[model samples]
Target: MRILLDSFVSFFRNNYMQLAAALAYYGMFALLPFLLLTALLLGKSITSSQEALEGLHRLTYQMVPEFQAVIFNELISLSRLSDTWGWVGIVSCLSCIFPLVVTIRNVFLTVFSAQRKRPVMIEILRDFSTTIFLIVLLIFLVISQIIYDELIIRFFMAISFPLYIVDFMVNLTISTVGMTVFYYAFIPVKVGLKHICVGAVLTSVLWAVINPTLVFLLKLNPKFGIAFGSLKTVFLIFMWVYFSFCVIVFGAEFIAQWDRRKEWGILSTKHGKNGVKETSPPLERDPPSLTP
Candidate 1:
């Protein structure tokens, strides 16, 4: 109990949320182009280009149902356009996503502030490696969405159950595993799987909740659209990214600090602070030099 309280205090004291906000801001820049590139890549491979486009469309709405109209409009525009920009957009998206990946790496490093330091070049290489990992994971996620989850869920839909439950379960598992891998791989410092698990579990819960919670909020208050106007979906996405990273940073902080809470006398009642429990202070030595 004491440890948990101190962890929250230390969490805010370090300004982890602000770092997440920056990651969110940069992540938003990467998301649109990355999604477009997925559609472009898949379209070229499949027998039906139209089928690829539809797959991207279905995936987007399943992730964020409240903004289906917006996603559809943009996807339609992407499909109707020539291939010239589609190729260029892929390159541009990679550039944006690289920096976002760099930021994510920084977030993990920042959380484990007291861990042993790596050489600058090694750290840079680690960041680049993790960035590649991130890109590959995303490609897999998009492909899986198109090929597996959507198909299986649709096959089951005839049996009865809202589409949202299927969507939630599929996404929940994927997001959790991704987060666990990200923390374990990207954090430059040596850390145990147990520590990584703690953060990953926390992040997965929050990430899973954000989408459905946003839908419920918008439904309860249709006025959110009025406030944001044409940018409603965009704003919501940005907020979603911000909160997602915030949760991730928080979990990392927990693992980093959990062992040190004892130093602050916050790990147990044996420290005898604030009447939580009473225990004797450490034994003290008597002075001998003064009498001599």
Candidate 2:
């Protein structure tokens, strides 16, 4: 616990500024259009069916009233806009995907320093792979949510409860996988699957708990709540990004600890052999040689 606390302190003292800037660069670009596109999509579904829209609106209101208002308004406006304009909105939404991915890659490079450990070519290749993986993951998540809304929600209302849990778990799993991939790809040390799984599980659980608690805290504090308004949206996004970095760093420590344990095991085996030699009965020295 002391070590963990020290590490956490070190993260803020060392990497907080960089993390903040990275999030600022990435969050601003990612959040607005992402939310807009999502709103547009939700709006389309809602226009097609009012009951669905109300259900979504209700969910959004519960989570983020202000941002939901913005999204709901945008969705309503987008629905009224011409088909050509709607297509444009869709394209605009899709356009942010690559930039968001690239921003993440840049942030990873800045934070992880994995590039320094591996060959430049290997690092770049790994980075590219990570980017592709994240992009695919994002798409899968969006599609999954859409499918959930369109299909699952229709048949089972109870599904919402499990769906929320699933959402948290899937996101946590992805975050862990992404971090593990980055660690192995860039870091000089090799990490095992067990280590990676440990990191992933820890990160996921941390995120699952931290996310909602942060939201609640933000909602409760007036200074943070209304003064920033949707700007808190930006801060919330930044906080999540920072938390993720913290998790990655924690995972790195876990990997480091694992490696150290292995090294200790090897060293202990050698030490035991040397200790046996020292402890064994000394061979009888021939005193006759000195007398002769």
Which has the greatest lDDT?
1
The per-model lDDT (C-alpha) reads: 0.64, 0.52
Model 1: worst 10 consecutive residues (lDDT sum): 283-292
Encode model 1's per-residue lDDT on 93-174: one tens digit a residue: 6777777877776665566553326887876676667665766665666666666554767686878878777767776666
Query: RMSD in angstroms, candidate 1?
Result: 9.9
What TM-score, computed on C-alpha atoms, does each candidate reach? 0.71, 0.54
Model 2 segments beyond 4 Å from truth? 1-24, 30-126, 144-189, 225-233, 271-292
Clashing pairs in 1: none
For model 2, residues 47-94, the per-residue Cα lDDT tens digits are 566554555464344334335676566656655553555566666655
Q: What does the lDDT come to for candidate 1?
A: 0.64
Ten residues in sequence with the least summed lDDT for candidate 2: 283-292
